[model samples]
Target: MKLDIQHETHYEYSAPLRYSTQSLRLTPQPSAHQTVLRWALQVPGKLFAQRDGYGNEAHTWTLARRLWRGAIHAAGLVETHASPWLVDAPALPSPLLYLRPTALTPFDRQLLNIGAQALDGAPAERNLLALARLVRERVAYRHGVTDVMTSAVDALDIGAGVCQDQAHVFIAACRARGVPARYVSGYFYAPDSPALASHAWADVCIDIPGRLWLSVDVTHGCVMDDRHVRLAVGPDYAACLPIRGVRHGGGEEAMRVSVQIRPAAP
Candidate 1:
């Protein structure tokens, strides 16, 4: 399936900023399950292209002039294959690296309990799906209740969160049981569910020796399919954020994001 995606992120600041720099992980890389047909980024400053620590196609955008508003636009055409699992080509970071805990995915007693219940059986694909389902049931999908800084434990405690939160909880649960799991940021082509267009999911290492990963959409409690266009993978959302930056003097900032995904014209 070919998908044309248009993403726009705009920021407005109460005070002008003297300098700003951002790391962008908005570009998608070709894999066994997806191919990037065409991609581009439009921003105010020059974008320095480089590969991030996780081997994600990344860019650094820097603006030295004073500004009160900024915008970033990313447009791309990608073709995704219908694959139940993603096999990572032999890469730098080993699967064991993902098992390590991060600030957003710290170990917790409640998360361990959840994992213990869902993973009572063998660590098969079905059991992983059950773990995702359990997360979805405990954490109801509700907006405005959680922020990007919310951790897995915090979201589990609140009992409500967005896709990111759910993914974090699922990752923590998997890691608690000595499973290698990582966070994935991507676009889900669901016209009826616009909010899901900008989505987050999890990738569990089912066969570490074979470098096979099972991509799970915890929010929907299913494996990823052709409709999912993966952007970046990391230990947590902070590492895979589409745009993360710091400014010198911007105060009281407000941000708005727009994402549109549709079938490409032949």
Candidate 2:
């Protein structure tokens, strides 16, 4: 399937910013399941491109002048192929690196118990799928109940959060069970669910030696397929944020994001 995607992010600041620098992980790389036909980024700054530690294409955007408002636009055309739930790719950074807990994916006794209960004596894939389902069940999907700063344990306690929270919980549970899992930030083409266009998921390393991964959409209780477009992977959302920045000023900042994904003309 071919998809045309457009993402727009606008920020308004109460005060002018003296200087600003942003890290962008909005570009997707060509992989076994997807091919990037055309992609571009538009921002009011000097942009430099480089590969991040996770082997993901990253860009650094810098604005030296003072500004009170700014906008970022990313447009692309990608072709995705249908494949099994498993993601087969070379492990650039060892999968073991994902086992370490991050601020967003910290595991406690609750998470350990959840993992033990869900993955009891099941096959690798089955156990991971069960874990995903259990996470979804524990954390109901609801907006406005959580924010980007919410951790997996906090979201689990709140019992409601968006895809990001669900993915974090799933990652925490997987790592608690001695399974290596990483967070994936991407786009999901779901016409019925417009808000889900900007999506997050978890990728579990099912076969460490073979470097095989199972990409599970914990929010949807299923594995990733052609409908998903990969962006970047890291220990947590903070590591692979679509856009993160720091500014000298820009007090009381407000941000708005819009994402659209559609089938492209043949």
Residue-level lDDT tens digits of model 1 in 66-98:
899989999999999967587776765889999
Q: How well does candidate 1 score on lDDT at residue 161? A: 99
lDDT of 2 by residue, 67-185 (tens): 99999999999998855344445648888999999999997988999899877652277777788888888999999999999999999899999999999998998889888899999
| Native-referenced Cα lDDT, model 1 | 0.92
- The TM-score obtained by model 2 is 0.95
Model 2 whole-model lDDT (C-alpha atoms): 0.89
TM-score of each: 0.96, 0.95
Model 1, runs deviating above 4 Å: none
Error of 1 at 248 (Å): 1.5
lDDT of each: 0.92, 0.89
